[model samples]
Target: MQPGKILVAEQDGAFVIKLVGEVRLTLCTTMDDFFDDMLTSKGFASVVIDLVDATNIDSTTLGLLAKLAIKAKQRFSYVPVILSTNPDITRVLDSMGFDRVFCIRQEPVVDDEDLNELPVLPDSEDAVRAKVLEAHRVLMGMNDSNRAKFRELVTLLEGQCY
Candidate 1:
């Protein structure tokens, strides 16, 4: 698979994030930071995550997406939209209980000419580990299956002191 890249664009407080190629834990820090800024930014309205070009999205990435959706709903009473076209990716999202948090769509986003690739931000090793752990915890809170699936991983991450 190709290396992962995150593209973003904002128009009138509505933000669009497009994930391309293989998305994994490596991009979690960047994604986490962006989510924080976007959610707290002035006039924050809505968010749309485009996954049509994403060939593979790892569990960690999914966890971060879950965190984004959960926070958006809790803080702003807003439910983000996720555009996913691939059957494989759609199945993964469904299994992760994303339908409960996000408005899942199977179509492409229009007016994406302004989308720009987000620069990958540098993060300390400890920061990355913490983000990963926090992300899994968010996923675990989403549903019983996620709790069961990520229990061991979260436990392991918690035990580490990096």
Candidate 2:
């Protein structure tokens, strides 16, 4: 699989993030930091996530996407839109209870204007572990199915932190 890459853009108060290639646990810190910055820096009226080019996305990346939608709802009363053309990805989203948090779409994002690549940040092991734990915790909170799905993995990840 190709390495993962994250791209982002802003239009007015609306922000767009595109996921390319394979997104995995290696990007946990970068994903976490982007979410933190996006939430705290300035409020967004809309957040769009494009996953059309994403070959594969692991649980950690999915969790961060969930976190974005949940935070957007809590902070701005908005449900972020996810643009995913791949049927497999849509199935994964459905399984993860993403329907409860994000507005999932199968079409490509109409507006590709102003999109820029987001730099991947270097992370320490501790930071990556923390982000992974927090992301999974958020996913587990979304519903019982997710909770059960990730419980064992979360337990193992938690053990690594200590």
Candidate 3:
């Protein structure tokens, strides 16, 4: 699998984020920061996550995406869109209950010319751990299946923080 890189663009209050290659925990901090900024930005209207080129996306990244969708719906009253063409990735998203939080589409995003790669932000081990834990907690809150799936991992992560 190719290494993952995140690309982003914003126009007229619509934000587009394209994930390329194998997206994993290494990019979680960057993803989290971008989500925070995007959610708070003035004129924020909608967010569309493009995953057509994403070869793989780990649970951490999926959790962060879930976090984005949940926050957007709560604050903006609209579900975010997720563009994903790969069936395997789509299956993963379905299994994780993403369909509840995001409007999943098996199509490509239009007008991607202005998209720019987002730089990976460096984070300390503790900060990364906390983000990972928080992400899983959000995922766990989504559904019973997800709660069961991530409970043990969340417990382990929480224990390690002490």
Candidate 4:
């Protein structure tokens, strides 16, 4: 069973967790432990999940994540951001009514009007840098062919910067 890997970084006052590798039935416990620890902590204004490196993900992980979102909503101070790209999983979450619950959206593929939809939290430059850097890192980690596409997106973002 592969351990569910979560790498945490801070952007603005928000915590960004990158979920990489295979997130399936085998790794549910690991993920559960990670979230439980986070849920008990304090300080983060929001949590962003970057699924750029997730090659496989199952329903179990999705359900747990959705529950996290619901729980976060109970707190007046913060919320958890969920990032996903797998078409199959995305569709399933949307069909199950989780799309609205967790703010599930497609993984940004190219630089375009859609990139604007990302949560930049303009008040925090640090958060902007973190998200941009994370996206770039994810792109760099991709296969040689996909790297160019991400680079283009970065450049597009640069031009759109206000």
In the range 40-146, model 2's lDDT, one tens digit per residue, is 76645677899999999988898888988888888888888898899999999999999999989999977666788777789888988888888899899988998
Judged by lDDT against the true structure, how good is candidate 1? 0.94
Models ranked on lDDT: 1, 3, 2, 4
Expressed as tens digits, the lDDT of each residue in 1-162 for candidate 4 is 544455566545465666667665454454555566666767647776667667666545655666566667776345555666777656655655554456665664232222211121123444443345433434334345435545666566555553
Give model 3's TM-score versus the native structure: 0.97
Model 3, residue 100: C-alpha shift (Å): 0.8
lDDT of each: 0.94, 0.87, 0.94, 0.55
User: TM-score-based ranking, best first?
Assistant: 3, 1, 2, 4
Q: Which pairs clash inside model 2?
A: none
Q: Please, what are the lDDT tens digits per residue for candidate 1 over residues 1-162?
A: 799999999989999999999998899989999999999999999999999999999888999999999999999999999999999999999999999999999999876779999899999888889988998999999999999999999999999845
In model 2, where is the ten-residue run with the lowest total lDDT? 38-47
What is the Cα root-mean-square deviation between model 4 and the actual structure? 16.8
